[model samples]
Target: MMNDIAKMQELWQEMSSWMTTYMKSFYSPEAAKTAKSHLEIKSAKTIFFDDAQIVDGIILKEKHTWKVVKNCENLAKHLNLNEHDSLLAKMIGLFHDVGRFYQFTVYRTFNDALSENHAKLGLKVIKDLPFMAKLDEEDLATLKFAIGNHNAKEIAPTENQRHLAFAKLIRDADKIDIYRVLKPFLGPTDGTGCSPDFVDLFVAGKQCDYTKMRTQDDRKLVRLMWVYDVYFAWSLKQIVEQNYIEDIINNLVQDEKMMQGITRLRNYIQEKLQTKDIWQG
Candidate 1:
């Protein structure tokens, strides 16, 4: 496992190098500066995760970030975004979870309710980065807005279409990778069923409050309900293709109400899968 982890780290390092070179050649001088700053921050992050005292925690967090970065790039390609938009997508992905490291290191837990909102914490970290100043005012705000709202149950409203688009893109990318991160942890429930409020939300086809999760089953149900919040057909396609939805449903409690929600979700997924994913921006 350690060897596999090392290899994954090496692969990310290589990809970072390649991305830096590609951006330098393909982007304008100002954009190249932004890319360079991104590389510098990424390098620092790699070192911090590598040298952290908690080896296991750092590895998982680091791997998740890399996976989200890849998902962002793939989603951008799926949308056929222009080069500038593509770069922005990837940058937002890279920094979206920047607060997770601090949250884990000090609090020793990733639960925002118990600790801090990692998304907001990440915005503070990004705002202080000297290199971030290299980005123009508009790009910088878009980056901040996307990262800030990435973990929110719903994105905060915005009038700028470009800002909204990037926010949606990062949220989808983050959730897609999150399903993968949480997959291995799926298991038999602790015998305590989901909370009543959670069940009501599920039955209503709505998202449950993460802070209200009271049981393992509730957590599983919350993951299932995330399908309702997914923004893009392309993201839903990836989630279904990987069997995340099926796997979560299989592990969920099979009570009548749960099944009703499951039936509703399956029908929704089927309909969503058939729709074309057209990027509006």
Candidate 2:
């Protein structure tokens, strides 16, 4: 257990070093200009949090736990990992959002569509970096797949032991965190209407069908349906256990037509849990 954590930390520190430098370049004045209209560059005050140490602690803990579970550690307790699995998960999670530093430095926001794909830029940084020189062939191969296609469409990995699952783990973990972060901040109590962008995404079906989800019931339904898109049932339970669905419902402004059925929403989740397979429920 300790060895896995230690190796993860080593890879994380190395990746962080590379990222800190890459961010320095990626968030420069020239870079901000390129990111215009997507993410506005905010003042340095917004670029960093009040405590650098806190950021490090949180990122390290979450990213490492995420990598382990995603690479299949949590799923199969006795599964022995070669150096490749550990290396791949460790390196990819560490670098996945280094582009975020640039987003803050340049765009002032983390919304992907409104901005750009941080994952894409992250890959560019890794490819351009010198760290590739230190990797073994297998190590590099795993890292390349994890880094390059971590955010792609959900598909089974064609390779041994399902390498792509490792990549999807980070994506699922990241989305769960997003739900946790944005749920409380949505600013509506009824869940009917949300920010215009949020509304439009649903209305257009460009996102899930939640535009008219005003009642707590509707909100719960939306969240239930969210399980369909979730990468794994483990991730689905993560949101449910965190009570993020309820938070989103309580935070949203209710659309009048959607208000009456709120209590039914919680019941629905309970109902589904009782009848559905736990792995899929």
What TM-score, over all chains together, does every model reach?
0.82, 0.55
Worst ten in a row by lDDT for model 2: 36-45
What is candidate 1's lDDT per residue for 111-215, written digit by digit as tens? Answer: 999999999888876676555665568878998999999989888988888888899999999899899889987777778889999998898899978888888
Put down candidate 2 lDDT per residue, 1-281, tens digits, no spaces: 57766655676567655544433333434433442222343332233344444344334333443443343433222223455455555566666666555554445555456677766766665676665756666666656666556554443456643455555655655556656544534445452444454344333323354544455444444543454455555555667888777666665555652343344445545555454222210
118 in model 2: Cα distance from truth in Å? Answer: 1.2
Candidate 1: residue 53 lDDT (0-100): 44
Top of the candidates by lDDT: 1
Q: Runs in model 2 with CA error above 4 Å?
A: 1-13, 16-84, 148-161, 189-226, 252-281
